[model samples]
Target: MKYLNLALLILFPVAWFAPLLRAALLPIFGMDEISVITGLQSLWGSDPAFALLVTFLAIFAPFAKTLGLALIHFGLLSPKTLPALHILGKLAMAEVFLIALYLIIAKGAGYVTIETGWGLYLFTVCIIVSLFISHKTETS
Candidate 1:
């Protein structure tokens, strides 16, 4: 379980790198508007079907990640930090959800895109693996 927890922590940074790298490199590399976050939006905003898919993902991604975080740290942290971690768990999902909601409702398309970059996919996988690790750790 400890090994798994360590593995999950390791996974987080690796998963984050793909989108991070693209977002950092795209403009410098002469790739116009190829942001991992906005690229997805630009790619699918025109189509209602794809847009809905992106919207759903954007809404749920944070929830999934934070929930994993919550489980990962729950009861494992020292008592003094437990409350803080709990609050963090609840709050961590907010950013992406708000951004996605704003894009879908206010922007009404054309301002951003949703592409589900490699980082996003990897992060999702990492969250799932983390959850599994959390469960296994808690039982033992």
Candidate 2:
């Protein structure tokens, strides 16, 4: 469980910078790769409130939960905090749903092209692995 949590700590950042989507607003322009970091960057310019929400879910929740769990594993934190960490993991998972929902809406518009990137899978895997690690930590 400790090792898995550690792996998530490293992989989460990689997932953030990796391309989660390739999107082209118009065919004249080449598709641009969008990672979590890039998406958040643009989002902040247009909608700071929504960007704050996404940043919490996409960046803070999972990473904090993982770090908190690591602290517990290393005897630096109370295991009593595990339940709160579990909630954080669940919140992080919601970001994936939001991404998918946006993709569906954008594709439905019939004017944009959207393609899933490997980073989507990687991000999702990191979320799930963190959730599993949380569960295992709680159980053990």
Candidate 3:
């Protein structure tokens, strides 16, 4: 579990740049790949508020939770912090929900075509893995 949490230090960053969605406003045009980084870039320019929320949920939350777990694993931090870290994991999960909601809305609205990309699954798996590690860590 310690090693798995540590692995997230590397995996999460890769997931960030991985393409989360491929969206095309029109079927005739090439779809643009939107990764966490690209989506943040877009949001930062047009909506700094949402950009901050996403940056926190998609990046900060998981990173913090992973780091917290790492510290606990190494005995550098107390396990009492686990509950707060769990909250962070839930926040990370929220980002996935946001993406799914966006996809649903875009698809239903009909002018836009949105496809789930590999990155979405990668990001989700990382979050779930982190949660599992945290749970196991707490149990044992």
* lDDT tens per residue, model 1, 15-86: 544562222222334423233345456647667786565544443443444444445555544434434433
lDDT of 3: 0.93
lDDT of each: 0.47, 0.93, 0.93
Per-candidate TM equals 0.43, 0.96, 0.96
Of 1 and 3, the candidate ahead on TM-score is: 3
**In order, how many clashes per candidate?**
8, 0, 0
Give me candidate 1's TM-score against the actual structure. 0.43
Worst 10 residues of 2 by lDDT: 1-10
Q: CA shift at 63, candidate 3, in angstroms?
A: 0.7
Off by over 4 Å in 3: none
Q: Which tens-of-lDDT digit does each residue in 1-140 have in candidate 3?
A: 78988999999999999999899989689999999999999999999998999999999999999999999999999999999999999999999899889888889977898888999999999998998998899899
* RMSD values, in order shown: 10.0, 1.0, 0.9
Model 3 error, position 57 (Å):
0.7
